[model samples]
Target: MILIINCGSSSLKYQLYTPDLAQVVASGMIAKIGEPEGYIDHFVGHRGEHHRCPVPNHRAAFALMMEYLQSPEYHVIECPRAITAIGHRAVHGGSVFFGSVLVDDAVMKALHECASYAPLHNPCNIIGIEEAQRMFPGTPNVVVFDTAFHQTIPARAHMYALPYELTQEHGIRRYGFHGTSCRYVSQRAADLLNRPIESLSMVVCHLGNGVTMDAVKGGQSIDTSIGFGTFGGVPMGTRAGDFDPAIIFHLVKDRGMSLEEVEEICYKKSGLLGLSGLSNDMREVSEAAAKGNARCQLAVDVFVYHIRKTIGAYAAAMGGLDALVFTAGIGENSAEIRAKVCEGLGFLGVEIDPRANEIARKGHPNISAISARAATLVVPTDEEKMIAIDTVQLTMAQPGAASVQMGHAPSTHGVAAS
Candidate 1:
C-alpha cells in the first residue's frame, strides 16, 4: 500500500492507497492537534465515516490513524506492514531539491536549513517525518516538495533584481509554493486540451486561503507570485501580500512599534479579512458585498482585480497563453469568483461559458469553456495524489519499473516491491 501524509501546522491528513491505487482504502484527518478538544476523523468504508476522538499531538494522531487503518472496523490492511511506503508533502525544499528524494539524515538536515523560508510549514513537516520514522521504522519514506515542480523556472525569472550578494547569501529568490497543485492542474489541463504538455504555455491560478499565480511556458515555470516567504505576493486570508517595505519602516520607526509587531500586522492583520473587517471566507464576503457592504465589496473587487491583473501580466510573459487553469478551493468551487476574474481578461482572448463554469463545480475535468484562442478549465487540486505518485516513483527501489508501476498502479497489478 502507498500511504500519503500531509502534515499541517495543526492538522494531519492521511490516506491509504492500495498497491493498485484503485480506491482510497482508508483515509482520515486529525484536526486541531495540540488542543484539548482536537479530534480524529476516521474514514474507512467506500464512502467512509467520521469518528471524533481526542488527538493531543501529531504523534498521538498518527498512532490513532495507524490503529484505525489496521482495525477490522476500517480494514484498510491486515497489518501495518501492508503499508510499504510513506509519502510526505513537504512544503519548502528551498533551492536544493529540484525533485523528490528519500528522507535520509541529509534530507532532514536540508529541510531544517530551509525552515527559515517557510516558518509555518517546514517545522511541522519535519516533525511529521521524524514521527513517521519512529512510528514505521524501516518503511520506505519520501519527501515530495511543494517547491520541486517550479524548480524548472529559469534564473532570469526566479531571481529577484536585488543586490547580487543578497541573492546569493540569503537564498532570496522566488521558489514558488503550491507547485504540486500547479503541476497536477496544468498536466490535467493539457490532457483535457488534448495537447502535449511540452507544446503548451499556460497560466495556472491557485486560489484558496492562500493564493498564487504562475506563468508556465512550455511546461516549465517562468514566474510565480509568492517570493522567498509565504507573506509576499497577492493578499490572502490574513497575509498582506506585496506591500512596500516603507510600510514596515513607518510602523517600526514612526509609530514606535517593534519589528516583530510590524511583521505580525503584515502577516496576520491584513488581506481580505482585514480589509473587509469581517470573515475571510470569500462566500461570506460576496454575500456581504451584495448586501451593500462597502468595505466587503472593496475586498472582493481587489481580490478579483489582483487575479485578473496577474493573469494579464503572465500572458505577456508567456508571449501567449494556450490555456487558463484554475485550481484550489475558491478557484475550483466559486463560479462567481471565476467569472469576475475573467471579466476584463478578454484582451487576452479568453472567454468562459457561464453555464459550464457553474456546472463544473466539483471533481476533476471541469472544462468550463473554450475560445478560438484559449481554453479555461477548473481542475480540482490533487496535491496529495501528486505527492504520492512522486514519492512512490522516487523512493521505489527498482528504477526501470517505477514509472510503469505508477502509471498503472491504480489498476489490478500491484506495485512489485523491489
Candidate 2:
C-alpha cells in the first residue's frame, strides 16, 4: 500500500492507497494538534472511529495514527511494514526542488533552508516526513511539491518589477501555489474533453479557502495568479489578494502601526471576512447576500469580479481559451458563484448551461453551453491520487526497485531505509 500524508499547520490528513492507485484502503485525519484537546477520525472501509484527546504535537499525532490503523477494531494494516511507500504533500518547494524526489539528507537540509518560504507549513511537513521515517523504518518516502508544477512559468511572467540584482539575491520571484490541484484538474479537463493535453490551452481556477488562478498552455504553466506568497492571487477566504503595497507604507509609516499588526490584518483580518463582517465562508456570505445584506452583496461582487477579470487576463495570455476548468470547494459546489463568474465572460466564447451548472456537483463534469466555443468544466481534484501516481512512478524507476514492485522493501540504491 502507498500512504499519502498531508500535514497542515494544525492538522494531518492521510490516505492509504493500493500500489495500483485503484482504491483507497483507509483514510483519517488528526485535527487540532498541539491543542489542549485534539480530534482523531479514522475510517476503514465504511466503518469510522472518532476520538477526542490531548494531542501535543505532530509526533504524538503520528503515533496515534499508527495505533488506530493497526488497532484490532480497525486493522487496516497488519504492521508498519505493510506500507510499501509513503508520499507527502509539501506546500512550498521554492526553486530548490522542481519535481517530486526521494527524501535524503541533502533534501532535508534544503527543506530547512526553504522553511522561511512557508514557515508555518514546511516545518510541519518536515515533521511528518521525519515521523514517517522513524516509525516506518525502511519504507521509501517521496515528496510531491505544491509549487513544482509552476516551475515552468517563464521569466517574463514570474519576475517582479524590483531591482534585478536585489531580487535575484533575495530569491524574490513568483512561485505559484496550488500547483498540485491545478495539475490534476487541468489534465482531468483534457480527459473529459477527449483532447490531448499538450494541444489544449486552459485556465484552472482552484477556488478554495486558498485560491489560485493558473494559466496552463500546452501542458505547461505559462503564468499563475499567486506570486512570491500565497496571498497574491484573487481574494481568498481570509487573505487579502492583490492589494497595493502602499497600504502597508501608510499603516506603518504614517499611522505608526507595527509591521506585524499590518501583516496580521492582511493575512487574517481581510478578504470576505473583513469585507462582509460576517464569516470567511462563501456559503454564509451568499446566504447573507440573498437576505439583502449590502456588505455581503458587495463581498460576493468583489470576489466574482476578481475571478472574472483573471479569467479574461489568462485568456489573453494563452492567446485563446479551449477550456476553463474549476475545481476545489467553491468551484465545485457553488453554482451561484460559477454563474456569476461566467456572466461577464461571454466575450471570450465562454458560456455555461444553467441546468448543467446547477447539477455539476452531481457528477456532470461539463457545464458548457451547446453554442459556446470554449468548454467550461467542473473537475473534482484528487491531489492525493496525483501524489500517489508520482510516488509510484519515481519509486519504481529507481535502481533495484523490483523489490518494491513485489511488495517488499526497497534497496539502499533506490532509497535509504536505514
lDDT of each: 0.80, 0.88
TM-score of candidate 2 on Cα atoms, chains taken together = 0.95
lDDT of 2: 0.88
**How high is each candidate's TM-score?**
0.92, 0.95
Q: Which digits, one per residue and each the tens of the lDDT, describe model 2 over residues 94-116? A: 76777787877777887888899
- Each candidate's number of clashing pairs is 1, 0
Residue 48 displacement in candidate 2 (angstroms): 2.0
Give the clashing residue pairs of candidate 2, or none: none
lDDT of 1 by residue, 259-328 (tens): 9898787788888898999977888988999999999999998898888888998999888978898889
lDDT of 1: 0.80
Q: Candidate 2: list runs displaced more than 4 Å.
A: 400-418
